[model samples]
Target: MVNESSVLFEKQGHIGILTLNRPPANAYHLEMLNCFNTSLRQAINDPEINAIIVDSSSEKFFCAGADIKVFEANTTEENAKMISQARENMALIENCEKVVIAVINGHCLGGGLEIALACDIRFAAKHQYLIGLPEINLGLIPGNGGSQRLTRLIGVSNAIQMLSTGDSISAQEAYRMGLINQLFDSEELMPAAVALASKLGQGPALAIAATKKAVYGGALLPMAEALELEKRLVDTLYDTQDGQEGFRAFVEKRPAQFTGK
Candidate 1:
């Protein structure tokens, strides 16, 4: 049985764990989407949090996708409101100050895959899980940045094939396609996620943020402009305490204790 709440949050060290708790398949409705945004905002706003992990309470479904019933019961405009919320949340995850990782231990489809795609890192269990964007079957396209992000992450040709066919791929196949960063056994999934978060937490927050900003922000710019942006970021980091500490630590052959300053 699942909890009544659609989203549950837990804080572990510098990591905030957001667990999807909807029954059946953790599909998103208005209530669930609101809860998710709330929980995620709480984590993002917490100064103590250095990283976040999105997981599911269900053993069989990371998320099946948006609840079709919500759309069925609403007018087209009403449905647009919900999709807008999802779009905002996806942007939130993509641009969060802290790193976000999606730990997928079960089926990840449609909006579910879009959610993972928005995350900075995705680690799925190397078991029976499948991942895909099957919105074509529902007479729709991916509405939550899936089409653009997927194309950017993988490539246009692969993204076109997947979006057009509405086909799902196994975890291994998804990994090969660069959909997920890593794969592990079901039992080791959470531990692996925690480990990665812990590792990132000890690094310089400002540098990490700048790197992410430069990479994502640069991707859309021309080569000349992107190089200038990268140079500007590097110059800014060189003036920070953490940056100095990193240089000193290297000289002294010691680990740098970053204060995220």
Candidate 2:
């Protein structure tokens, strides 16, 4: 019997792959959220894993959003717990040093889209794959980082329109809005995501972390403040062992071994 809980974790070479495995319309639940948190942490802690790709196992639905059944039967305490679980799960993805690429193969709705938004990059299948935050339909807004992240990804105006209207958009529209990084055919989605992750895995891990931090960390800051932060970050990297290795390797015309120190 398949588990109705949240996730399935697997490692492929240097890439850690996480699948949202709750099937027949994968919907979020507390157990699933906990599982995702545990799995993401495990992947992050593994030094051998240089990157992560979050994908779905089911054909029709990447995730159908939060488990409405849980909400339907919920007490106030239960609702609070569920919200907390989701927040933690999204934080796991967002704060992870290793780059995460969300492979949006099917229905990427509500909490599903929120989780995907936490990733460093997103690759989706063509137009038919629906994606949006529809929590407003249920008398709620996205409790995770959806509002903030979506605003950062697209823009405040587009984010407000999408979230407020509770309208699902095609993957093509998402890409056009600068919400998704790339588009792939349905048959090629997994391979494309894997290829992208593998490419990232082979690069300097520390540099990737620096890049992620500089962009996301500085997004809300003033231009001068962001520039200062970037300068400080680059200076920090300059004094590190990885910096030395990178320079020496460049001089020797060889690939640098990044210890992620």
Candidate 3:
């Protein structure tokens, strides 16, 4: 679907899966990012898809970050465009209406971790893999929404330490640090991630989208403003068909069949 490329997209029921397919390590460049963005847009535009998962085809390297070759012998204009594309891709993940989950079954470093951070949730394998923003080691820093999102997700001080040090931490440490939502056995990673996505996919899509908007968007505003935003979102949901269906189902002691209306 993407010129026989570095990413693959497939649908399973209500879930959309995007798999990084570059061999050895899914180190992405401009072309790969373009394909990845296009696939994500396809999922986002699909009305039938309620949840999406970002995964990989490799077992040893989730993604080794940007291909270093992109930085070699490239003009300033080309370099800027590359970084801009990476930033836009990250924003695409964060601003997507459908719930997104990143399943990290291998080492996730630098830009890879940044991509995971943009997702609503992350689950990693329990294998002895490392995860971090190791850009400092290369005498550069995360330019793909990593610095901003990482700080917001994991706190300023911790993010600063991790970025400044540019060192990869163990999967166990990443879990304890809240870098990942949970850790699964290597064999269970994708299945567990898919299980959660499937459950979410069955939920009321509009209300779930509203809640996600409230939490992520409201968190950026002041306290009073945030409360207002939440209240507004809740108020809107109450009038939706699914909301009424839920109420009637409860009164009738029957399961609600939401059509994501």
Best by TM-score: 1
Backbone steric clashes in candidate 2, count: 1
| Candidate closer to the true structure by lDDT (higher is better), 1 or 2 | 1
- Any runs in candidate 2 off by more than 4 Å, and if so which? 1-5
List pairs with backbone clashes in candidate 2: 6-32
For TM-score, candidate 1 versus 2, the one ahead is 1
**Model 3 TM-score, all chains together:** 0.96
lDDT of 1 at 19: 94
Q: What is the C-alpha lDDT of each candidate?
A: 0.91, 0.87, 0.89
Compute each candidate's TM-score over C-alphas. 0.97, 0.94, 0.96
- For model 2, residues 215-257, the per-residue Cα lDDT tens digits are 8788879999999989988988886888899999999999888
Better of 1 and 3 by TM-score: 1
Query: How would you encode candidate 1's per-residue C-alpha lDDT over 1-261 as one tens digit per residue?
Result: 223389999988889899999978999987888889999998899888899999999999999889988889989998888999999899999998889999999999999889999999999999987799999998989999999999998899999999999999999998998988999988999999999999998889999899888989999999999999999999999879999999999999999999899
> How large an RMSD does model 1 have?
1.8
Tell me the tens digit of each residue's lDDT in model 3 across 1-261: 333389999989899999999988898888888889999998999999999999999989888888888777678898788789889999899887789999999989888888899999999999898899888988988999888888887788888999999988998988887888999998898999999999989889999899889989898999999999999999988888999999999999998889898
Segments in model 1 whose C-alpha atoms lie over 4 Å from true places: 1-4
